[model samples]
Target: MATFDSFFSKRTLIGLALGQFVSLVITSTAFSSSELSRRGISVPTSQSFLNYVLLAIVYGGFLVYKRKRSLQIKWYFYLMLAVADVEANFLVVKAYQYTSLTSVMLLDCWSIPSVILLTWLFLNTKYRFRKFVGVAVCVAGLVLVVFSDVHSRDRGKGLPHFKYGSGGSDPVKGDVLVLSGAMLYAVSNVSEEFIVKKGGRVELMAMLGLFGAVVGSCQMYPEILANI
Candidate 1:
């Protein structure tokens, strides 16, 4: 008796949890791998571009299979989402250059509160007292993590010796970047929620992937040319 909407309702929490786990793994692995690599590692924009490319391919295939008609939403809307997503990914990835993996991960939780506030303001979504309490707890946790950054000295042998991005190995700068990225991610997520609710498109994810790939690739082109 579970309908399509029911599947999303049932799995939303689970999906969120799994997504967090996967993101942590990806970030941590990227940090560790880049430090150990002999050659220069991929930059944040390149990594984001490549990820979206694969995503777009998969999603494009899905659209082909489903035989969906024209894209329901405006191209600019997807451009907005793609820009937010690409910016978030670039910022978060760049943050690793300036701070510990632990610090970046902890600070990235800012998206939860950011999303809540943005949804309230733009989406007109309401929350209960408990939700606010949860945000308070998240704030407390962020404070603890930020304070902990001052005591962190474990860079380990695998980490790179030189600075990677403009962040320049400053924990505060890194934390700020992570927090900013989280806010952008919140924006993208809230927009996606609104689009899904209003447009009622089951293939929203695929469309996002397609648009993200295009925008991300375009953004990466300049960096690639400069580096080359």
Candidate 2:
């Protein structure tokens, strides 16, 4: 007979994987839709503001509404995480605007190494030599992808454009920014894990979404105020 632990292990793993897949699909679809909307269409500031308002509500609801009773949230930690989260997005978007999208995407791959290093440092996690080698190989693959940014120089269609080197599109600056964003995201992930391990209640997807929406709305308050 299978033990309860064994049964749960399989079920939990499957659920987690499925949730991740679904989340990835949803996220990718949203980005694709955003890009399509941008194509040959100039969105007005009012429209963008309205979009942000909707985004805030959507994210807040998705991230933190349902798990109210058991949600042992530490606001300070969340604040730090939120700041990093905001900065990461800003940096990546800026990088995208200033350089080729291909370069930005390629440089974002640094997150793997960033996460491993951070996990080792903060979480005190250890890895086998093979895992370290695997990370190295992955980083090498990222370098190859960066090299292939040559293909991205044709933009305004679907693909990203590239302008490598100085005075054109500095891959160095763009990659650095994207790399930083990836590292920040990794840190945020590890921090969330830490939070959960420390008995912070399992925030339902809906709850998380809600919290994210509220927080995102708050983030835009300054801009809203400025415009007003």
lDDT, model 1:
0.75
Per-residue error for 128 in candidate 2, Å, reads 1.1
Models 1 onward score TM values of 0.74, 0.60
Give the alpha carbon lDDT tens digit for every residue of 81-195 in model 2: 6556655655665564445554555577687788889889999999989999999998998777555544334432343442333112555566676778888878777776777
Off by over 4 Å in 2: 1-71, 144-168, 204-215, 218-228
Report the number of the highest-lDDT candidate.
Answer: 1
The sequence of per-residue lDDT tens digits that candidate 1 reaches over residues 1-228 is: 777787778478699889999988877766663462224444677776766777667866777788656767777887888889989988888787677666777788999999999999998888999999999999999988776554443432245663432223577777888899999999998998988876545456666777788877777777677667
The worst-scoring run of ten residues by lDDT in candidate 1 lies at: 33-42
Task: Give the Å error, residue 78, model 2.
Answer: 1.0
